[model samples]
Target: MADKPTVTIIGLGSMGQALASAYLEAGHRTTVWNRTPAKADDLVARGATRAATVSDAVWASDLVVLCVLDYAAVDELLAPNADVLKDRVVVNLTNGRPDQARRTGEWATAQGAEYLDGGIMAIPSMIGTPEAFILYSGSRTAFERYEAALRVLAEPKFVGTDAGLAALNDLALLSGMYGTLAGARHATALVGPERAAEFTTSLLIPWLQAMANILAPSSAEREAGDREAGDLPSEESPLDMQAAGLANIIEASRSAGVGVDLLTHLLTPMRDIIAAGEGDVLTDLVEVIGKEIRS
Candidate 1:
């Protein structure tokens, strides 16, 4: 087998430090740099080389990972180091928009470097665990070259060649997570906090696990903007029944002195669709939203 590649981590935030630690633990030569030099002290103590500057960090490794604040910070750190970036592979795990990823990919390519935009799907604590997986897009060759090294951080998922694909899917996954959390919060509010722990553990977890298993595949299709009307399953739960249940939920929440904002946010558009005489099932809303997005 080939020798492990040296890895350079360009940010020392919690996530950046985790990445550096994983690399160091895997016995890769790890170099780390942060704007505030003090942040790298712990990692340096763990056998990581602390680079004095961002350019020096880039120069230390063929695989340079960036987990900085944003695209602006990424650009600020990288622009000055462009000369040294040639032939190197840059993996940016920063949170950013799809367009920003595309633009950054272009900029990196112009600098004669291979760019792979990354979407980290786990928290810092989850890095290096089986539960953590990262999405990558752009420069398939670069990804293939460093796939083994990258897996030291998390399972690597290559989404596509479009630089923005990773960011797009990342935001989509986060949207699902926030939506799930909102519903869970509303459910907990329906029960008092005293009961939340038991409710979530005994009822909510299994219920949601089953629902997710049933819904996730279809949700994936809708999210990809590829769902056609015919692709929707036969109406298992009609909107009329759903609307009645939702109305009852709203009434109960109001009676319990709980806010109905989240429920109403769903019900209002739902009622509008039903009133507009354009929808019969809940999934119909997907078509309407798709059209709105297209327009």
Candidate 2:
């Protein structure tokens, strides 16, 4: 059998440690470094090498994985070792804006390294698990070459050759996740503390799961291509109906002394759609949002 590729992890934060552990457990020769130094002790004891400096770490492996504090820290660490980065594949999994990812990708390329900007969709504990998936964008060739070793960390999704795509999708998914959480919090508040647990466990979870299944297809269709602005499906729940329902929910929440801020975001767009006298479907709100975003 071919030997597993060597890996050098250049951060020792929770996610970085998890990445190093995954590679080490998969029988790869792993080298780890962190600014604190002591963070590499555990991995070093598990048959991994402890790099004395960032240069040593970069020079130790063909695949260099970075999960640092931010893009600025990434620059601070890699700049000094720029010469050692040549011919290596740098997988940056730092959290940052799309622009930052693209700029870092350019910097890595200028140093003669192949780059892959990564957006890890999992928490530290989920690394190497079936449920975890990390998005990758940039250098299709590099991704294809190191795909196997990368899989040791999580399921890798190659989004595109554009370095910014991974970060874009990452932030977009996070926005959706946070929006859902906000709605969940508002829902729980509406039900009062005594019933919150039961409501979430029994009603909210099942209802959300079912609604997600129904809504996903429509979302997918919209994303597949550019549709006419008014091309909304003739769904059962029209815009006026949804707007009225939302208005009532707001009123009820207000009367019950529960905050309606989260619910009002949806209501605002629905009201605009009704006032515009456009298509009547609830999905028509998508067009309203699209126009505002484009503007």
Candidate 3:
């Protein structure tokens, strides 16, 4: 049989460990390192090598994957070892902002390392499963070279050449998730604890799935700058009507002894769009919200 590729994993947190485990399962020779060395005990026991220092880990393999806690932690760990990283492919899957990823990519490039910034869209438990999809950007050459190895960890998505693209897309997707969760929390609170689970499983999930169908086409329209094209305003929900309904939601939540904070926050943009008399196209609120953000 052909030999498997070698991979070094830095950071032995839950996600980091999962990454290492997946590489090992895929028959790769794995080297692992963590600030807390004891955290790597299990991996070492599973036939993986343990590196005593960050430089040792970097030198152990050409393909290095970092799943550290944050960009700050990544800097602290790798900043002093630039010399060891030369000609190496460093894939950083740390959760961070786009600017941070861009800065890190620049630093890595200066040190002669090929860098790929990644956003992991799954929890640790989902690593190595089809459900996990990893978004990567920067250093297309490095990505292509290591694509086979990366696929063992998750479904690999090469987003763009800009190092910040992955982080930007990651944060955007997360923002949507958090916004949806905030609305769900308010809904559950209004319904009370006893029926919250049932409501979510029975009503919210199916309703949101159907709403997702609308959002998919709406997003395409927004991207094409043709807000009037898809599912016209006459057939769609109106902003004035949505704002009025939000007011009712806020009032109802307060009456039910739950906080109206989330619903009230949502109403701000709707009110802004309504006052500007742009309520004719409900989706135009996206532009209104973006303008508010820029201001």
Candidate 4:
């Protein structure tokens, strides 16, 4: 078999280690560096080379992958070695905001390195597996050049040319996930801990999945600019009725000695939409949210 391309990984955190391991397992010459050199012990034993310094790591390979704590840490580590980064393709898988990713991309460009901001959707254990997927944006040329190597880690999804695009989508997806988590916690609290496990497995998971399926078409309607055209029949429960149902949830939680905070917070926006006289169609809530975001 042909030897794989060499890859350098900075930051030996769990995710970073997973990345290096994936590359190594794919037969790439993997060079790894971390602030705590001892963290690379196991990787070194696994045939990964340990770089003596951050600059050495950058110099080790043309494809440098960074999976650090944040954008700040990324800057702190790479800023001094900017000169060494020239002609390298630096792929940052750091978790950060869109603006931060854009700024870092600019900095990398200034140092003559091609930049691609990436968002890993899977956890460490899923690395190198088909279950893992990664979102990437910016430096399309670089992405195409190294995409084969990247696919060794996970499925590479090139989102757009904008450096911030991956981060934006990443945060948006995570926001949806956290919202579901909050809803699950509220549901479990109302049910009591004793039955929460069974409730989640047998009921909550399936119900939430069904609810998601229902919302999918509504989302498509909104995207297609059919907000004025109610996705559901007018005979269906209106926004006001939905708000009342939320109110009932809050009351029931309070009565059951469970915290009503999540339900209360959720209802606030629905009430705001109603007060703004935009609750005629259920999808009007989307417009209300867009307005609030713009304001």
In lDDT terms, which candidate is top? 1
Per-model lDDT: 0.89, 0.88, 0.88, 0.88
Model 2, residue 114: displacement in angstroms? 0.4
Q: Ten consecutive residues with minimal summed lDDT in candidate 3?
A: 226-235
TM-scores vs. true structure, each candidate: 0.91, 0.89, 0.92, 0.90
Question: Per TM-score, what order, best first?
Answer: 3, 1, 4, 2
Error (Å) of candidate 4 at residue 125 is 1.4
> Which has the higher TM-score value, candidate number 1 or candidate number 2?
1
lDDT score, candidate 4, position 115: 97
**Which sections of candidate 3 miss by over 4 Å?**
218-235
lDDT of 1 by residue, 51-118 (tens): 88888899999899999999999989988888998999999999999999999999999999999999
lDDT for each residue of candidate 4 in 1-295, tens digit (9 for 90 to 100): 1556789999989899999999888889999999999999999999999999999999999799999998889989998998998999999999999999999999999999999999999899999999999999999999999999999989999999899999999998898899899989989989999999999999999999886766545655668775444244343667888889889998898899988876675577778888887665566656655765776
What lDDT would candidate 1 get against the real structure? 0.89
lDDT of predicted model 4: 0.88
248-283 per-residue lDDT for model 3 (tens digits): 988888889999876675688778877987665667
Clash pairs, candidate 2, are: none
Clashing pairs in 3: none
For candidate 3, the lDDT comes to: 0.88
What's every prediction's RMSD, in angstroms?
3.9, 3.5, 2.9, 3.1
